[model samples]
Target: MRHDSATLIILLAVVALIAWFAPDVVLIVFAGCLLAVALRAPGVPLARRLGIAEHWGVMIVALVALVALGLLVWFGFATLADQAREFSRAVPRVLERAGTLLEGLPGGDWLKGQAQPEAVQPSARAAANFALAGVSGTLGALGNALLVLLLGLYIGADPTLYRRGALALLSPGLRPRGEATLNAMAHSLRGWLLGQMFGMAFTGVFTFLGLWALGVPLAALLAILTAIFGFMPYIGPVIGAVPAVLIAASHDTSLVPWVIALFFASQNIEGNFLTPMVQKQSSDVPPALLLGAQALFGTGLGFLGILLAAPIAAAGMAALRVSYVEGWVEDPADTDEKRIIRPA
Candidate 1:
């Protein structure tokens, strides 16, 4: 018993060490899993329709998506870059104005002081180093993007390979149940990816149109941010809307209310209409549970954790219900079958 206990403790320590040191790799793999689901979701239907292999169908769909994305970037990247640059320059002025406006409120003086930039000047060498670091970071991001793409392709091409390997970790008796749990988890993730994709697109399109109609600056950039962050539930939309509201407030205080109203309406539609319609087939998780998971994982794993928090929570909840709660924890104490089979 002591030997078994020691082995269990050592195994847990190893797992903890890996989690602490390799959060990024874990997140990257998670991204690959999500991409695989996204690819497989449409690929399976296309394969059936075209009488082609599922893998081939996935490749074709991926290629089409890549082409569409390339064309979009080609046409829109220049405008986005310009707007991003303008927004960066405008940020300081906007902050200053915000500080002034809040001067009458509590902590307003401290806030204004914090917003006021220090008079310290950096050397040209320091500026050069900053620029070099920015370039390095951009290149690193590109590298990570390529890695994620390759991982996704490999995983999506033969998902069963990985699934089989995962199931192998279980004892023979538990393997069947493990496989079932994995299938359920896959369904949950696939449903999530579908709902999330629709939500992001819906949020982006409506936000762009509404902001443009309101003549808001940086509307396109803001819309893109909104769409990307829309994947995160509850807190994401609020974070996405803040910049647009700030920009509006800087331009004209009156426009602030209009910008807020637009976001409010969009969120209402998303919460009431789009989410329900899309998530109907998806796994259901409580909002508070999801929020708690987000907070915990986000603190430990940063942005990637926050991005995938809901799916993780849903999957975990499903597994616990299936394998733990239903299987043993809540098993009936006295059953008719058991009583009848007892010794006379």
Candidate 2:
């Protein structure tokens, strides 16, 4: 027993070291696993209904997704591209306007002085360097995304292979529990992903309509950003709202209130109505814990960390409950009810 505990500690230490050294790689692999779960979540049931193999269902889903994505790009890419360009051009003007507004406020003279050539030159140089770095970073990110997609497709096609490989790493006595833990983790992650999908879709569609109704510039771009960021929970919506509010303030001060109200309404609906329905059908992560996880990951690992934080927290919670709580603490013969994590 002591030897086993030591081995577990050593293994954990090794994992920590690897994660510290290659955090990006770890995040990429985790993201791929998440994508795989998403693919399999619907595919498995479809396969059962169709009397087809699971892999075939996954393949069909992948193909359908690709086709849909291609169609969207074909039809909407030009408009989105134009809007993005306009948004980029508008941002500098918005910042300039904001600076002017700030200058009109109390302590404006000091703020104005701080913006003089001495401070501006270094910022300009930094911006140029950042732009250059950004190009390479974007290319690298695209490459990483492609890699993740391919990995996801492969794993989704034959999850059992990977599952068996993971189980093989454990002792024979521990393998059964490890397998169960893995199943629970996957269930939790799938539930989280499904809920996030609904939230994102709802937020994006409503936000776009609201912005368009208000005649806000770059509605499409802003909506897309809000939807993507919706994956991150509480912090995400706020980050997504900043640009929309800035643009609205710059375009027309009157429109700012309406834009803010639109986002607030969207969030209220999602938080109060949509999220509860989803949680009833899936695993629930406490809001406080979720936020804590987001902060920890965001501060430690940056954006990719923030993006994957919720699922990681969900899976981690599921594993602990299944492995430690149930295995060690719970009385199996007791009639007391316990929450079970399951896929929606």
Candidate RMSDs in Å, in order, are 5.9, 2.9
Q: Quick one: how many clashes does candidate 2 have?
A: 0
- Which residue runs of candidate 2 sit more than 4 Å off their true CA positions? 1-7, 104-128, 331-344
Using TM-score as the measure, the top candidate is: 2
- How good is model 1 by TM-score? 0.87
The local lDDT score (0 to 100) that residue 47 gets in candidate 2 is 93
Model 2 residue pairs with clashes: none
How high a TM-score does candidate 2 get?
A: 0.89
Report residue 29 deviation for candidate 2 (angstroms): 1.1
Q: Which stretches of candidate 1 lie over 4 Å from their true place?
A: 1-17, 117-129, 330-344
lDDT tens string, model 2, 10-42?
767888998999998889999999999999988
Worst 10 residues of 1 by lDDT: 335-344
Clash tally, candidates in order = 0, 0
For model 2, state the Cα shift of residue 248 in Å. Answer: 0.9
For model 2, what is the alpha-carbon lDDT of residue 104?
74
lDDT value, residue 44 of candidate 2: 87
What local lDDT score does residue 100 receive in model 2, on the 0 to 100 scale? 66
